[model samples]
Target: MPNWGEWAALAGGVPVTEERDPARDAARIEQLDPAYHHHDPSVPERIWDWIGEQLDKALGSVGVPASGISTVLLFVLVLVVLAGLLWWRLGAPRRAAGRAVALFGSGGPAGADEHRAAAAGHAAAGRWTEAVREQLRALIRGLEERTLLDVRPGRTADEAAAEAGRVLPEHAEALRRAARTFDDVVYGEHTADAGAYQALLDLDRAVTASRPTLAGSTS
Candidate 1:
């Protein structure tokens, strides 16, 4: 696997807390299949070599040994955090961006495109309630990403429509209707249908193509 440390090191180094241990790297490599740990300079070997070099450099910067298990663990945690931030930047769960606790009791996608994909998957599987919910999530996230609406954490579907309505008044009624559909499937425990999902999907496409009116301006 690539170390990914080179890119991570661009963030700069901190004080190292551990010393290099020769046996450590060998032990880790040993844990993997010997078929993959060979000395051949084949493509895979080259890739592994590059990863090793990058890791060594990053470890050197922070005075942490490449074999420093504790430092490696810390790097894993930092990587996870960076991943979460990237997810947020891409319009995923804004720490519950889709809304109330029940809105995401089973978790959700990590971005607008992802939500749309999930919605499609559900629709294909004949899961209309799930499809409607995910489609609406895509709409909300897409709006937020385009700056049509502020990225408000914990905002409900209705709040999202109401707020977005101020800027896209032409779509106000449609947005409200869409929000109600979302609330019905998500909170009202109502079942949805292909028609409902299609309606939300159509609205999502329309809103994506429609330009939001500038603040204090008329369309």
Candidate 2:
């Protein structure tokens, strides 16, 4: 096997001279033309080329295309403007309306609890008509909250009933009967008894049990 120096010399194309003189060799190297024979730094040329290639690949990987980025930014801006306009104009009323519609049919107030309270208040005041009216209103409001009807104060029980049957097939019968009973007590001059009150309570229970509970429901 050849020694390291022999191998290195052979690899480097160094001549195998009979006499090895360090100073002479140094002098001979120095005598060579500086313009034609230049010394390169130890770093390989392929290292620099590889670094540049890797940089290009890294940039391609890290950054999205300009066109794609522009399109995404435009879409975001449109959504922001639309949402801002809607909030400014309607003040979340449409969302509330939708939620109320989901909760009762019109999405007016929160739940049957509110109706029960209103009815109780009316009953305590000895206003049987108002109590009955409130009870019916509770039922209607429940439907409205459930998103079954578009509840307006001026809307009649008949109209609400029809809409309930159409919009909330599940709770239509309850709404219809409650509307009728309320109308009877309020307009038809029927005296509300314990049975009427119990009926209203029963209806209230049914509504609370059946309808989905709405968050942030308002009157």
Q: RMSD (Cα, Å) of candidate 1?
A: 23.6
lDDT of 2 by residue, 74-169 (tens): 787899999998665444453342232221224433454586687788788776666666666677677677665665655666567667566445
lDDT of 1 by residue, 64-165 (tens): 765784568678989999998776444344335444433333466967999999999999999998899899889988988897777776677778888878
**TM match of model 2 to true structure:** 0.39
Model 1 global lDDT (CA atoms, 0 to 1) = 0.79
- In order, candidate lDDTs are 0.79, 0.63
TM-score for each model: 0.51, 0.39
Model 1 regions lying over 4 Å from their true place: 1-106
Q: Which residue runs does candidate 2 get wrong by more than 4 Å?
A: 1-115, 124-127, 211-219
Clashing pairs in 1: none
Error (Å) of candidate 2 at residue 111 is 8.7
- Per-residue error for 16 in candidate 1, Å, reads 99
